[model samples]
Target: MTDASTVIAKPVSQNRAIWQQFRTHRGALFGLIVLGVLAVVVLIGPYLWIPEKLSVAEAIKLKNQGPSWRFPLGTDQLGRDMLARMMLAGRISLAVGLVAMTIAILFGTLIGVLAGYFRRLDGPLMRLTDMFLALPLIPLLLVLVMLFRDRVASIIGPEMGAFALIVFAIGITSWMSTARIVRGEVLTLKEREYVLAARSIGARPHRIILRHILPNVISPVMVSATLEVANAIITESVLSFLGLGFPPDFPTWGRLLFDGLQYMQVYPERVIWPGLAISLTVLSVNYIGDGLRDALDPRIRGR
Candidate 1:
């Protein structure tokens, strides 16, 4: 008679063990700390205080103002507070990155798991995934943006429309890598003794996948997700800078870059701030992803 308490405790104990192992990786620990700080800043900084509404006339005064006591980062061409706008923009950029990556990860994991577990589906599914992989993402995204501009604006309103488009574009394109990674992991895991045991016990396919396979495959998925966030963010910035991103009324980091590019010769700092923000955020995310990969893989740890 298996004790229910013991059965529940086993999973909790296993989770704790994994966490303990993860903590031992120094780079991952550092990355976590940095990411935590950045996340807090992005989430809380905008809500602490509100910026005064500047009429188009009043907004003209601070245009291209360099770093000073009044404005820490400086004012943009529109006279909007650079620091305030940067922080505000961070919210949108980060949100899109996380949400888009989450969509990709969820869909990719589902496809990968199904394909890997059912051998008959593997060839066709993988080839389809390969097709997406083969297509050029940036050009496709540009075409989609142009083709669906009016429809997207009507659906989500101007403020959120561009963000949503960026998310969809990134999510659809980014899943290929995740699917490939998850497929490989699932293939190896599905053949393990525990999976065979579960099958022998009359566990349904869904139950076996959920209970036995998902746990083992989740580590790589997590690493992929972290890295994809950075990719998505960069993609959003590129789109925005090309004047295809969020409308002027609602600014994002990429939009700032676009606005700043005009004044780069007169006030280079306008371009610098947003560029730095994007670079730093992406760099930090990549570092964290690297850490997660190292921490999650025993082979890397052993090496």
Candidate 2:
């Protein structure tokens, strides 16, 4: 169905140009590499280095040990290996960020593009966005968790159920800003010369949006996506800190930090590893987002 030669000749060059553009920003490149490596480590490290000592009994005697050869980041109050727990924690934290971002992006982009492209839906959608913006996010999340946590847990097993509930709550709560950003971009893009050209050729509104509008507005959408991931991660951590998210036995970075707070004076490593992980992850994502914004922007790509 497709001509290999045509793609080989044309698409390769286009991709090369994009890659070159992306590579121009040193910080973005570094962030991309770090993020890629961190993702791999978190996703794979758990399997290769089993955290068999994750259970309570193993840590009972080994508790509160500092960093050493046996336990790289040292043992926690329960003596669980910090290194192993961090890997598994990274898995859950990253998963929450990614899944939540996907839901947010899909809903935000849809609402934004529609509201921006059509006048009929604009007022209602924007009003809804404004209403959400006005609400207190933390309180709203607490209410949702209280109301549906058990119900959701009953529908799905606790692990996945908590995952879905947290992701859904964060995604629903966080889409307003993205929607606004996308709507603003769409409003500008719809007036562009190419969009007008598409209209002159009798293109359907949906087709024009899909083929012309969305592609052009992707830069901002991507920027929003990165920020959304960071936000979701932090929000989940907060939920865990409040004991409303994943179960207590789970090793989320936030939970780890919360657990280690009281022991900070004695065994600081309990807080250090997870805290550093959260800080580094958020910082890397922010840098990557910054790099992406410049690389993906036509105006700045080559500069």
Query: Each candidate: what lDDT?
Result: 0.84, 0.87
- Clashes in predicted model 1: 0
Alpha carbon deviation, residue 289, candidate 1 (Å): 1.3
**Winner by lDDT:** 2
Off by over 4 Å in 1: 1-26, 299-303
Model 2 C-alpha lDDT per residue in residues 1-303, reported as the tens digit of each score: 898766755344655666777788787788788888889989989888775535567668788888888887887777778888889999999999999999999999999999999989999999999999999999999999889989988998788888999999999999999999999999999999999999999999999999999988787899999999999999999988788888867778988888888999987777888888888888888888887777676677543
Question: Which window of ten consecutive residues has the lowest lDDT sum in model 1?
Answer: 8-17
> What are the candidates' C-alpha RMSDs?
5.0, 5.0
* lDDT tens per residue, model 1, 117-221: 999999999999999989988889889888887788898786777677778888988898899999999999988999999999899999999999999998999
TM-score of each candidate structure, all chains considered together: 0.89, 0.90
lDDT of 2: 0.87
